[model samples]
Target: MSTPQNLKLPIPDVLASAICAANRLIQRLAQPWLVQLVLRLAIAVPFWKSGILKWHGFLQLSDTAIDLFTQEFQLHLPGGPYPFPAPAVVAFLSACGEVTFPVLLVLGFGTRFAAAGLILMTCIIELTVPDGWPIHLTWVAMALAIAAWGPGRVSIDYLLGDRNARW
Candidate 1:
C-alpha cells in the first residue's frame, strides 16, 4: 500500500521545530518521582482534610454528621435483620478508611492499596452523590493513574522496591 498523502500536514518550520523542542524538554523534565509525588499530595489533601473532619465528628459524636448520614448519606442495607444500622457506624468507618488510606498513599506505603481504596470510596461517593460526578471523576482518574502507574520514585513504594511491580 502506498503512504497516504492526506496523513501529512503542512506546518510552518518554526512551529514544527518548536514542537519538537518542547517534546524533548518534556521528556527531560517529566520525571516519574516528581509527578508521582505531586499526585500523591494532590489526591491526599482532599481525603486527609475530609478524614480529619470525619475523625473530629466521630470524636464529638456530632449531631450534624448523624443528621447528614441519616438523612443524606444513609446507605440502604439490603435484606437484613435491621432495615438500617446506625449512621454513625457507617460514618465512622468511612472516616477511618479515608484517613488511614490517604495517609498510606501519602507515605507511599501500600500505595496501590491506598489508591484502590480511594478509588472505591470515590465510586461510592460518585454513586451516592451523583450530582457531584465531575469532581469525583477527577478524583477517580487520579486514583486510577496512581494505582496503575505506582507512587513513583520518591515514595516508600520505590524504596521498598515495588515501584514497577504491582501488588
Candidate 2:
C-alpha cells in the first residue's frame, strides 16, 4: 500500500502547462474582493426581499407582517411552541434588522457587525421555523464566513481604511 502523499500520477508536459494556465486564469477571475462581493449580495438579497414585504410604507409595518408574528410564528422551545413575546415589537424589530443588516452587508460598512447581526437573526428564525433549518443553516454559514473574513477590498470598509479589511 502506498501512502497518499507518496503517490503521484505522471502527466504530459502540455497537459500540465494547460492546467497551470487554467488555474492562473481562474485565480485572476476569482479575486477575494469579487468573491466577498458575491457572498454579500447572495445573503443580502433574500433578507432585503423579506424586509420589503413586511412594510407597507416607510416605517409602516404591513398587516400581514403583524398577523404572521401574532398568529403564525412561534418559538419552538423544549417545553412548548410558545407564542412570541410582544409579537408586534418582535415583528417590527425583525423587519428593521432584516432591512438594515443586509444594506450594511452590501455596502460592506461595519461588515462584521452586519454579519453578526444576521447570524443572530438566523438563529431566531431557526427557532421560529424549525423546519426551515436547511435555509437558516445556509444563512448562518454565510454570515459566519463574512464575519470571519470581514469585507474584502472594493468595499466601503476597505475604502475607509479599516485595519482588518482583507486584501
Candidate 3:
C-alpha cells in the first residue's frame, strides 16, 4: 500500500484553533467556581461544628428546644407541629440537618436537598427567630444561590453527573 502524504494544517485553521483553545482556557479561569467553593466551605465548616454542639446538648434541652434555639438568637417560633411540641426533637433535627446539609453541600452530594433544607430553616429563622433578623435571610440568599447555580467543578455533584442532578 502506498504511504499517505503527511497532512498539513492551513495557517488560518491553526490560528483559529489556537484562538479557540485560548478562549476556552480563559473562560474556565474566569469562572467564579473557585469563589463558590470557598464560600460554601467557609460557611459549611463552621455550621457543622456548631451543629455538633447542638447535637450533644439535645438531651438537656429536650423540652422547648425550639424555644431555646430561638432564644439563643433572642427570638421565638410560632405554634406549629413540632414532633409533639416537646422533647426538642425539632431542635435536634434542626441541628442534625444543619450539620448534615453542610456536609452534603461541601461535598456537592445531594446539594439540592441540602440547599432546600437551608432555605427552609433560614426562612423560619428569619421569620421567627433571632435578634439578627437578617441572619436567616443571608443564609437563605446563599442557599438560593447554591440551589440556582449548583456546586462548582470540584464538587461531588460534578462527579456524580446528571443522573444525580435535581433538575
Candidate No. with top TM-score: 2
Q: What is the lDDT of candidate 1?
A: 0.78
In candidate 2, stretches whose alpha carbon ends up further than 4 angstroms from where it belongs are 1-18, 165-167
Candidate achieving higher lDDT, 1 or 3: 1
Ten residues in a row with the worst lDDT in model 1?
75-84
For residues 1-59, could you state the per-residue lDDT of candidate 1 as single tens digits?
Answer: 55786565657877899999999999888877777788888999998887777644335
Alpha-carbon local distance difference test for all models = 0.78, 0.91, 0.68
Q: Flag clash pairs in model 1.
A: none
Q: Give me candidate 3's TM-score against the actual structure.
A: 0.62
Order by lDDT, highest first:
2, 1, 3
Give candidate 1's total backbone clashes.
0
lDDT of 3 by residue, 66-116 (tens): 657544433254563232343256577777787889999888888777888
Higher lDDT: candidate 2 or 3?
A: 2
- Give the TM-scores of the predictions, in the order they appear: 0.77, 0.86, 0.62
